[model samples]
Target: MPHDIHIVTEAELRDIVTLDLALVDVIERAFAALSEGGVVMPPVLSMDLPQANGEVDVKTAFIPGVESFAIKVSPGFFDNPKIGLPSLNGLMILFSAKTGLVEAVFLDNGYLTDLRTAAAGAVAARQLAPAQVETAGVIGAGVQARLQIEAAHLVRPFSRVLVHARDAEKARACAADLGQRLGVEAEAVADPAALVAKSQLVVTTTPAREPVLMADWLHPGLHITAMGSDQEGKCEIEPAALSRADVYVCDRGSQCAERGELRAALAAGLWDRGTPPELGDVILGRATGRQSESDVTICDLTGTGVQDTAIAAHVRARFPGAGTVIRA
Candidate 1:
């Protein structure tokens, strides 16, 4: 008899997992596993649909000794917002590592991606940001922009937040919403450079093809987490900004060189391959983090398959028997 396959819904995931320190720890462990050579992850499969302003990415990973692995399909239709639909959507397929059997399907509609990405930001902040941060900054007003700041607060106490967006109204609304939710002072800034100047830690979460944050505005004792630009031709920070950082890190150097911020820097001849250590190396004590209080650090995060695997495992652990097991 075949096992009954379990199907988990987005609503259920929302109820079970949250964007907090616990999730951050899970993501951190995933990075440590990667650095320790305990995970098998392949290059992401990506397809671009220029006419529709959309892109699709497929990612997967297997962690040694873990019961299950996950393959996630993520799609982003930038024009969806014009029709009142979400710009991002996706699901994960979980399989038993031992017997190659389908165990569950998480129809999370990209919730896990958002959760893990935010958690990754927090992990970066925890490892590189100054110990005391009163003000944090974000470059976009989308769902990720809000979540990154929320996650950062879990690691550092931020009393205020500054947000910069191309649309002034959207930035103001995002600031207001964040202020209400986190009970902190949140304000909108007209200039991205100004936001970078005022913040001790900054997160860029936009989908822009061009640079939004620049190097000239970056100051010492500041840390940046660039979470956008997971696809080709998308960039949030200028290549020069990366050059200015005393310590430059990436979630994965190979992936970033192909699609993340490092791609642009490498193209510009500003960065060398594998010059910066992977975030996992820092987390695993294989590399140093934040050597001095005045050191500037930048973390370029290109969404990784290990993160999907880790978050999937965590969700399964938290909600056992939530899915219907199906026979293979």
Candidate 2:
């Protein structure tokens, strides 16, 4: 059997494993693969689409190690609720790392991307979070927030889970659903300040253009995973909050500086551009993650194309070209 070049559809990608396993595993593998070397996953290339309410943008990533990385082309047509459709739409292209071959196409439908990002939350929990956190706080009760609740439970096993969203009802619903799934107590917090003040660990998953997280609200021994601000002008966590942190880590400094949560900090003079280390640097033993029990650590994830390649590898390997092929 020659390498069966299979291309999976969006429906197929949705039928994969559960959120905890797929999302967390993809993220963990992405970082691990990067640390092991031979993967060229640069920060994504994106341009703003001002015609589409300024929210719409086109971004593509090329992973040199995978032979084929994902373009990850997506458009944020968030007004789709009235139109009865999804807000985000896109597909992931998995090309053969060898021979520069465009091997397979996986119709991610944004699910794989979400999972990989959630996996980064899990990794942050493992690496940046302290050993004694009993309460966890989540900002933005969306799909990614739900996944973080699941992943954090697997790592922290918090006694209480707190969530805050722009919509209180949605936050309540997410809290209930996450609590039901994780077998823990979950509550919809009044706001970011309330949530951060109560929990030892915090994960933000909003796409707010301004800061939702407050600097004065955080307590000591807090570990923050800023997941929402992966694009320029999209910031959830406040830059000043980072000043209170003892350590700061990022998925990629170059990528984050242009688009991640750190962009706000860099702009506000809240952080030293040369100080925060990349997660790979920490994983590869080139830098440190946590220093003290009293120290605060923040992991800012901007996401990378290598994650798509890593997850695509797992999916492709499992299927082994199990779809119809079109040679073009």
Candidate 3:
């Protein structure tokens, strides 16, 4: 007898899965499982193509007690948009943990990645941000920028949002869209410093190879989620800014030290090994989150395989036995 396999299309996924608190909780559980040593996640495999301005990353993980595990391939070609295509696309392959059989394939085209990434930001805010958040800011006007703010609103009731982008028009458009979706007073700002100064919670979602947000702009009680620097040589926040953080957290210390904002800090001799606690540790009660209302914090997210696995399992549960079956 042959087994059945499921194939989830991008449209099918978008119709069902949303960037809401439920998804946030799913990703949160993955982090907790990771911190508890209940997951087997290996280092990410990444390839860079500077000539083409593109990169690809492969990540996977096995969580104890989960029925399935997922392997994800994510590709980012910066030049794709110039040819009228999206810069990001990818898919996830789910396998049965019990027998190693193919279970399903989520052809999400990077939507799952975006959703999990944004959820991680919200999880960071829920655990690390100050109790009261009136104003928020985003450092990039991309898709993730808007999603990050939407996810943040689930954890905190921000009344206003400030967005900054290299392109003034894009920034204004993003601000308007966010304002309508979140029902908040979202506006575009020309200065990154002004956005940072006015926001209690800030999210950076750019792909800059250099620091865009400086340390001098950081204020007391501000929590910054830097999700931009997921690759080597890519930095969105200043190394000095990380040094000023009272609590610096990362999704994974090993990944961060090699490819996240912490990497830049370590290279400059500003940070030492084991300096930044993994976000999982905080969630598992092994470490503290916000020690004081005025404490400054930063969460460096480089993306993890555990997130892919968790989301895959969640989606499979939603649409059980709905795809075509294949004979092996």
Candidate 4:
């Protein structure tokens, strides 16, 4: 038997998949499937290259009824900017669930990953952020920081945005870009605490090994989405902040405990709350979300393979079917 493998370029994928509400819904359904159980997702395979200031991660998931599944390979080199290259890049391979045959190769150059990750932040905001968010703050000036704010605005429209980063120049530039792009007030806040003080929603997108957002900065009606600590040894929020939140959620409790923010919290003996609710459960109404306007909620997103598969399948379905196809 022979099968056709479609080779999709980054341009083709970019044309099909944009970070919009529709893509967010696709990610949302992925989470719903995760909570309903029976989804076979393997633990992430991660490797750190200390000498190169880089890391690589491979992730995949098999949904019971989905026609295809995806395996994604992603690499991040923090010093890529020095060489005029992006810090992150990757591709995804989709295989037929029924036949275990190659279906497509998505050479997205990490664009899909970026979109899905940002959409996950939006999902967290939709379920956890306050009903009316007048001010939104993000603690990072990288690509994720910009996308996260845009994605969140799609769910909870904010009148202003505050940007904070360790680099003052980057923060100012990111703030200006966001303000012009979002058509809203945006400024760079020198202090993380000040940004949190005036924000109803705050997202941490830095790849910091130390805590960037502290427990003391948490205020009422605040929903924090920490998305940078997907790897071990990465900590964006203070360990104690997990315990301090009125309701702390994880994208996946088990994964979070091993590699996400929950890992740090557990090591510090701060996550004694025992089995925190996952984002999927909250989305499905199986658990609680922001109960009151004054509630402080936090969601720890470590990224998931299901998102990769979901987004890949979506692009395939929407594909023009004119890519380079190789039969195997």
Report the number of the highest-lDDT candidate.
Answer: 4
Cα lDDT of candidate 4 equals: 0.93
Q: Write one digit per residue (lDDT tens) for candidate 3, span 89-186.
A: 99999999998888998899999998999999999999999999999999999999999999999999899999999999999999999999999998
Give residue 56's error in model 3 in angstroms.
Answer: 1.8
**C-alpha lDDT score of every prediction, in listed order:** 0.90, 0.76, 0.92, 0.93
Whole-model lDDT, model 3: 0.92
Supply every candidate's count of residue pairs whose N, Cα or C atoms clash at under 3 angstroms: 10, 4, 0, 0
Candidate 2's C-alpha runs over 4 A off are 1-4, 21-26, 32-38, 54-68, 325-328
CA shift at 276, candidate 4, in angstroms? 1.0
Local accuracy of candidate 4 as per-residue lDDT tens digits, 58-160: 9999987888999999999999999899988999999989988989999989998999999999999999999999999999999999999999999998999
Each candidate structure's TM-score, on Cα atoms with residue i matched to residue i, is 0.96, 0.89, 0.96, 0.96
Report per-prediction Cα RMSD to one decimal: 1.6, 2.7, 1.5, 1.4
Clashes of 4: 0
Candidate 2 TM-score, C-alpha based: 0.89
lDDT of 2: 0.76
lDDT of candidate 3 at residue 161, scale 0 to 100: 98
